[model samples]
Target: MEADKVKEACAVVAMRCKQDVAQYIYYALRALQHRGQEASGIAVYSGGLKVKKGVGLVSDVMGPEDMDKLSGKVGIGHNYYSIKVSRPENIQPQSLKTGIGDIAIAHNGIIVNSQLIIAQLKKEGKLFLLESEEEAFIMRLTDTIRATDDIAKSIKTVCKELIGSYAFALLVNDRVFAIRDPYGIRPLCLGKLPDGKGFIAASESVALDVLGAEFIRDVMPGEAVEITEDGFKSINIGASINRAHCFFEWVYFARADSVIDGMSVYEARKRIGWRLAKEAPAIADVVMPIPDSGRAHAYGYALGSGIKMNEGLMKNRYIHRTFIMPTQDAREISVREKMNPVRAVVEGKRVVIVDDSIVRGTTMKKIVKMLRDAGATEVHVRIGSPPLISPCYLGIDMTNRDQFIADHRSIDDIRKEIGSDSLAYITIEGLVEALNFEKENLCLGCVTGEYPVNIPGERRRFQQTLEGFT
Candidate 1:
């Protein structure tokens, strides 16, 4: 709940409809606004692609006049959160012109081998105009489209040559294509518009819900879906191995109202809370969440622990998420500005504070201080997920392992660092059990230090050097 939590990579939404789709894409982006907030953009194909994008919130970037200008029947939208520097040109849906027509792409997740692909494309005389990796990767698709007339085949060809996680919605003129990586390290779902006049694909089903679209199913790992006037068609272009969906999608990234791969995210969080209560119960007078993300888990914890759940913290709905703030100092300030402890609920009481996960511990320390200052006798911190001991190279930006308190300190040490009377984390086994899935089906790389995809030895060495564990 602190501003120092893990940050989501991005969110993507694409729709092919009979009427103008700019408005629909706009609303869909708003629904997915929680996934990313740094920048937002939309590209629509009326005759050729028309793009309107900027560096700001969705409402700030796309006003009524801007939406009116992006009129089209087929379109794609993007919400971006930059782990590095924020640049205007990096704002997607990144577009390019090709001999056949205009192509635009909006993507979520990191493309690990983008540099290698960029080098290869340069050798082929392909020029890249944008500085963002997603833009350069889209240019590679342009080359493929030039080589092959078929869009799906081109995506399949280029996908085979690439590594790492990605979920993409691309618009080539009027046709819309949605592709998920081989491993499905990110989430993407397909849906049908009302009256069956259109199709929709997005990073989560909540986008489809906002548009009154019927939930169809998830875009299988390694699959590409093409939406044309005829309907929806798909092809499997992913790896032949087992899927490794990101576990964090259930733990923190997704909206509680959304479902991913037949699993309800809210139900998953509730199960985590119930299991945590059984695995690591805290004797407290009241069980309360840190607001927003921890609410559902806290409910489950309260239910399983036979304690009353109360709103002990009031969150400022207007403030940006602290984890996405540009600087540590800004994040620190936002931690105080974002939430306030309800003195009436926690005063003179032993409080159990439920949170999704802890990353840097800086914000958690501040949160505990806020509770103590509000007259809580004792604050016991309960995390719904296991301690994040490693970095996530797939998409969610916890890349700097040195920032992970659990990686450097034990539970007792972390308790002292965060200034909590007591602290506990959901065990890895409990987390897997709560998901009700086979251990191999989920990517627990951040907790276990075992990645499904192979990282180059040099990259591993660099991470170790940065963590000072080399």
Candidate 2:
């Protein structure tokens, strides 16, 4: 499943009261839903942070009818995508007890070297129950912070001792704070309200824009921002060498209009498509994109190949969830609803289909069959990404090794399975180059399996990663 900007924790905290704070939080979460769709939760702290979470979209998690009931002047929300933990129960805004008091924490991103931290805690007789390391983080921090009265200071100290990727928010007592890991593997941003009585913390600036809040600068890597009565203040936890950003976030996962680190995702994708055309030129009557993810790359491919890019297929915007679902049948159904070949454009023409990545062959097979049904003379499949051969330990939904198209079959086999006349993926080096990103700065674990951290012995901890929305 594609993880979007929704995973970063969202919150609206104010010492003073606002009657429409819950509505405001709902709008904020809706904008951030692109980050995670699997599970969603909201914890509101008017006096006590009451939490409600379920598996699905924000509308489903907190339905339109239910929004009024969830209204609060102070609140935090979480949208979950199962990157490391597939079970919906692990989806967050998790409430837990510590030695000092009880705290509610919601997090986006991964904790690298999580297994080591878990093991160390276990050796010291700490009980472990949560599947995600994010939950483990709550327990670890709770225990550590019990030694201090200042929650922000405790978070800074505890985060300094940990390793891995993260953009997180915590509701301890009446205040809220957001933190970004040193490596900045994921994105988190802050927003300001019109009256300055409330603030929001989210994965993308798009969320803030949706909430009608002014965009503040991003929560800097290795930094923490506190949302309190004073409005907001920052704390620096220091930085490290591993500032590796996930290139795919811009390539396919992120919304095209969203920007990261002052770079436009849509433009970057067009750049990749343009680079693809230069590197892998193919003769085709028209260039076809694999519906949603491939559009940007297809545009790029068109610009570079000097070939006309046409809408060879139309997609149903209301396609069912295909990313995290467990069955191939569901995915097949989604492909049916999501895309259909345009015979008028493709008939008797040599078609070049461009896509962002190939996770499994099932969806592509049906798509190719659709094109054939539309009377395409020749279909050449070109992928914009390198072959994925390993599982991602970071916060992505692709946790199963067996489900990957690249892991299970050779190129020829995949081509045969998809029923394409020819199939070519962007080489690993080419993909890295196309992204125009530094290899040393990327967690290419999925493409190369050279994970920056160690894997846990609990192998089945994450499987059927495509389940819910985000």
What is the C-alpha local distance difference test score of each model? Answer: 0.85, 0.71
Candidate 2 structure quality by residue, lDDT tens digits, 35-81: 76677887766555567788888788786666666655666677776
* Tens-digit lDDT track of model 1 for 258-293: 999999999999999999899989889999998898
Kindly report which residue stretches of model 1 are placed more than 4 angstroms away from their true locations once superposed.
83-85, 321-334, 458-470
In model 2, the Cα lDDT at residue 110 comes to 65
How do all models score by TM-score?
A: 0.92, 0.84
Worst 10 residues of 1 by lDDT: 461-470
Candidate 2 error regions (>4 Å): 1-20, 63-73, 83-89, 97-99, 112-132, 195-197, 229-231, 322-334, 408-410, 454-470
